[model samples]
Target: MDKAFLIQFTGSMAAVAVLVGLAAWARIGRPSPGLDEARARDLLAEDFPDRQIDQLWIAREGRGALARSGACALVLIQVGDGYAARRLSWCQASSAMFRNGQLDIRLGEVAAPRAVLAFDNWPPKDLAA
Candidate 1:
């Protein structure tokens, strides 16, 4: 390509990188506001009555929750009403990423996508992968 074109493209890319860095820095200090265990337990209990919740992560503003039981993994995300639950039995997740302000976890697919959970990362954890 032309020298001038390459220079302009490099400058634009650098600007984009700087903006992304600033956004990430802003999210650094703000820790996730954890969820109430009692409420989370109650919600998890609704779907998984038999299986006990082993691990739980809730969004800051009570937007969503990621819960794990002995048998399966459950994700309760805010749609329109309250929180809708998505269950994963075999647990074949491919990738999980937290970006901008949302946490997106992708599961393995057969015909279409097996499962996908998109929630806000509260008590923001390091999602460097």
Candidate 2:
């Protein structure tokens, strides 16, 4: 290999590495901050302005939340750097299993399919309805 060619290739690789490091430091595409009940409600409000959440439960470590509005249920999940909301009836969920104070709900959708919410007690009664 020619010495000049090798030097140029090495320099290009270093430049790419530096750019990646700078992007990481800047938190480009970094995930959104953890959510509280109030923040989760705000996100739901944006996507579901007409609906009001009657009850809500925030997931462990702020991963997501479960909320009930009238007869419909809504889930707030983290997608990339933001949150996404899905409204569902109880029948829409493929499954919901509770174990160790967590309720795992499967919505059976292609985009936002599943959510695991944590509660201090067992799953809420209205969750199944």
Candidate 3:
């Protein structure tokens, strides 16, 4: 192989390796738990013991100029009522952003409305709310 060609190829490979390494490093400490509805429900249950959650919705913030959206999951829990409209806010520290973050649940034409619950850092004294 020509010396110049070999050097160019090696440099390109090194650049690619650096980009991959940077990406991996950046994502290492980040939370990528797939933030699905099931996980959100589990977090809600752990956070709120007495209160029962009937429905859950997860919404991700849009990005870039085009406003590309992220993943979202809808969870339906089997409670006395089918589902209800409720407002919930999850703690930032916890990964329960699905139900915790800024979002609203609508009952619409549903027969029952799901009770909205927010999961905070510390457990509340009374689980009534």
For candidate 2, the per-residue lDDT at 34 reads: 88
What is candidate 3's lDDT per residue for 1-129, written digit by digit as tens? 999999999999999999999999976653334445565565545545555553333434211000001222233332332222222333221223234533223333355443233333223233222
Which candidate number would show the highest TM-score if scored against the true structure? Answer: 2
Candidate 2 on 48-79: residue-level lDDT in tens? 99998888877777978878788778888777
Clashing pairs in 3: 83-112, 83-113, 83-114, 84-113, 84-114, 89-100, 90-100
> For candidate 1, what is the TM-score?
0.49
The residue ranges of model 1 lying beyond 4 angstroms of the native Cα positions read 1-35, 89-94, 106-129
Return the candidate ranking by TM-score, descending.
Answer: 2, 1, 3
TM-score of each predicted structure versus truth:
0.49, 0.71, 0.29
- Model 3 segments beyond 4 Å from truth? 30-129
